[model samples]
Target: MTRADYVMPSNSELEAATPPLWSIEEQRPRISAVDLFCGVGGLTHGLVQGGIRVGAGVDIDPACRYPFESNNSATFIEKDVNELSGADLLQHFAPGDLKLLAGCAPCQPFSTYSRSGRSKKRGLDWQLVLGFGQLVQELKPELVTMENVPQLADHAVFQDFLGHLDGYHVWHSVVECSAIGVPQSRRRLVLLASKLGSDGLRLDTGDYGKRTVRETISELPPIMAGEQHAGDPLHTSSTLSPLNMRRIKASRPGGTWRDWEPELRAACHRKESGASYPSVYGRMEWDAIAPTITTQCFGYGNGRFGHPEQDRAISLREAAMLQTFPADYKFVRSGEKIQFSRLGRLIGNAVPVRLGEVIAKTLTSHVKMIFG
Candidate 1:
């Protein structure tokens, strides 16, 4: 299969095509939500699926503007979160109506993997979380939700931000993505805060069931290395270097390249400095969930983004599905180019839609118990 095979049909074609397998009518609504830092509307879409009406999504990235609007049918404001005011958000919804403010601030600075040697001197990236705190203080919505890498729990700034919530009841947990039905082993810090007090905000624990890679992507049409699903450009796989392709072929499921013969190893892999980074140049196992998909998911060297059995990186659709986005979720619109940088950022940065559904469900139950 060639790259063209995986290209997604134009947005107009998809819109004019059959509707999604699941419809908005199937969901049960409880509250209105505003998605801040709404990357491709993952949380917003999931909230919609769970019956919450998302009023608006705010983010600075232009790439997210289209997918967020297209998929959620919500207005997208392309602005940095720092620029938003409480009054600006109030216009989206009327007074006396129950409102929820949800955000997943950029996690790079708070991430354990940040390459800045855990130094606080790296200032710019670290300020994004501060911006989120500012908005929370301004909006003072009835309910608040935040999702981020678990590292955020340990950050002093985050602690201070929580303190600022004052009388609001807050419950936070470091949730494993697999436990929430996202077909990845990603762990995130999830928080749900409510002005309704302690009894109103808690997540109910559920049995952790495993979701395998095959269950997530096995049904998609097969394509060769570097090819897109013929019917969906957004489902295309990344091109691989010839040597890397050979290396992937020799790789065992869930095994790192260290399992291969010395000749197959990259030069860095042979160095002492590279010993600690065993997860790079790894292959995913068919029967297990994938490792956390990160911003650099399009790059094979980033982590275990390789196909379980195929000799190429996972496609955009596969990544989105692993993140628990519905298969038919519209990404690029009609006449738009599906650039990997833009698409990958959207997928990598999104809150897993399944995770969002769980959150919305929990919040809905809480609201009903308190104010229904």
Candidate 2:
């Protein structure tokens, strides 16, 4: 029989595809996954899109339950990963031929913000990383995957974590997230470990064309300062102070603070240290990838988050889109007022759904090669 003629959609149209998982129509075994630290189910959604049967997701934040469950056909279990046993997680999986345990522990400790050598204490964020390895060792799932900040692989904690997998073959790389279709330029460390004695796939950046910021959000309905788009409440932008509004109006896309009029310049911008952080208060370049979308991305003062032509910061919907969340992905329950801080954390902390799809595709291919 000849192979069916099929042309995959471009990166820009990835989310528009119905049912998310683009290749499940073919013969493939059931490979279920349990997402640990599944904030708002970004990884779970993308994994589902890549054809994995995600039975459930676990996270400490109870708020994630609605969005996680609403968007994907998966249960969201509210609990600290530390409190949950691998056996408990494994129970979510059916007697499938293959099971996967996936998670991306919090990356704050290894983030550039915390790299000033200022901390004398190690918090649960670090502990969570170690705990991830512990669970993997305990459960010994046939396939394993994790995604985190690129700096994580350099940490001594990461080294010790690797030691736990004595016999598992590991394949890992520092992934340039934007290259893999995420609309923002973010780098992450991704690891795939397998007890199957074969190396798993590492996603290829060259496989697809890059998406641009304009393509991701330029079509989103406009919103004024402190106003939500009537079309979609989630498209609400943060209200700017009088001075900030003027500053954004004077700003040019991709331009820095130096481009602003002297009268609108903030006191900090005049300082020598501020030159290193030029992207703050800057408008995004429409044709390029966005700067990394952080938890505070809804604020104009955070990174280059200003709208390219509008006189306001990027809205919640825009930020989510840059993270490659589907246009219709729900972040709030019915009648729930969208909280900026909570939504920001959810969108920023999420693994870009597209990147998750890349990981899922990699895992699915390896499993099929070895099992089918």
Candidate 3:
């Protein structure tokens, strides 16, 4: 399915104070999939949007259960990918249907940011990626895909993943999100492998043009720092300290904390060592692409997460939208209190739905060329 063909919540439905009741029509698609490490179902939602049927999503985080199941027509299996066997995943697919496995492993350990940190605790997380490859080797799925930080492209684990695809036609490259209609300036490594044929399938990186911050979030009703929009609870912004409030007020869009008065600048900002990290305490430019959304994006002090016009950091909903989630994609179930850290991690760690859609589209085209 194309973007125009994909259904979305109506404006009235989206504007409702609460999510609509969960319902999805039963489907028996020829192309079926199971999403591993499917945090909050961003990639699964995109697959569904691209006209693929996803049987279920697997992730260890129980917090992901609600959103993953609520937003899409798929079951949520709370299990670690490392512990899941190929047989465990195979049961979700129908016999004779094309099987697809998507695993976007946690990228923190392989991210450039993590490498710059002093901590070595995250070093072992890259091993989790190997489990995905193990499953692909055992299950011998008809198709497989993975997405991660571009830095991971050079990692040994990635080479090991390619090693698993002995009989499959594989292709991978770093895809820029702005090229695919996502509103953020994020780049990710994308891999696609197919056992269908020697047709030499490759991804199609279409020119959708750049999406800007103003184009993406300009229509939403504004809320101030520490306040939630009465109409939508998820539209709440993080409470800023008085010092941050003053600092943001002095800041201009696209400008850093250097714009602050000498008294308002953080001690770190005044220090020579802080000059390299200019993106911190910065506001996004309204008409330009947004900075990459990080897990701590709701905090104004985190990266360039400050709102272009508002005096607060972007809300969780704004971050989700920037990540290409639908306006009304429910993260928290109704009546559940929104937790900023948990929700932010789910949103930031998610594959941008637009990027996922592009991946799905590429798969769809390849499947048609091979099977039709």
Top lDDT hit:
3
lDDT of prediction 3: 0.84
The clash number for model 1 is 10
What digit string (tens of lDDT, one per residue) describes model 1 on residues 53-97?
788999888877778887876889989888889889887652334
Q: What ranges in model 2 sit over 4 Å off?
A: 1-28, 114-121
> Between which residue pairs do clashes occur in model 2?
21-49
- Global Cα RMSD, each model: 10.1, 7.1, 7.9
Task: Give the residue spans of candidate 3 off by over 4 A.
Answer: 1-29, 115-123, 198-200
Off by over 4 Å in 1: 1-29, 94-96, 116-122
Q: State the lDDT of candidate 3 residue by residue for 1-372, as single tens digits.
A: 222332444455434512221122422124679999999999999888886778899999999999999899889999888888899888787544578999798887766655555256455566678888999998888899998889888878789889989888888888888888899999888999987764536667777889999999989999999998877789999999999999999999999888888999888878899898899999999999999988888999989999999899999999999999999998987778889999998998998998888888888777666644
* Candidate 1 least-lDDT 10 residues: 20-29
Question: How high is the CA lDDT of each candidate model?
Answer: 0.78, 0.83, 0.84
TM-score of candidate 3 versus the correct structure, residues matched by position = 0.89
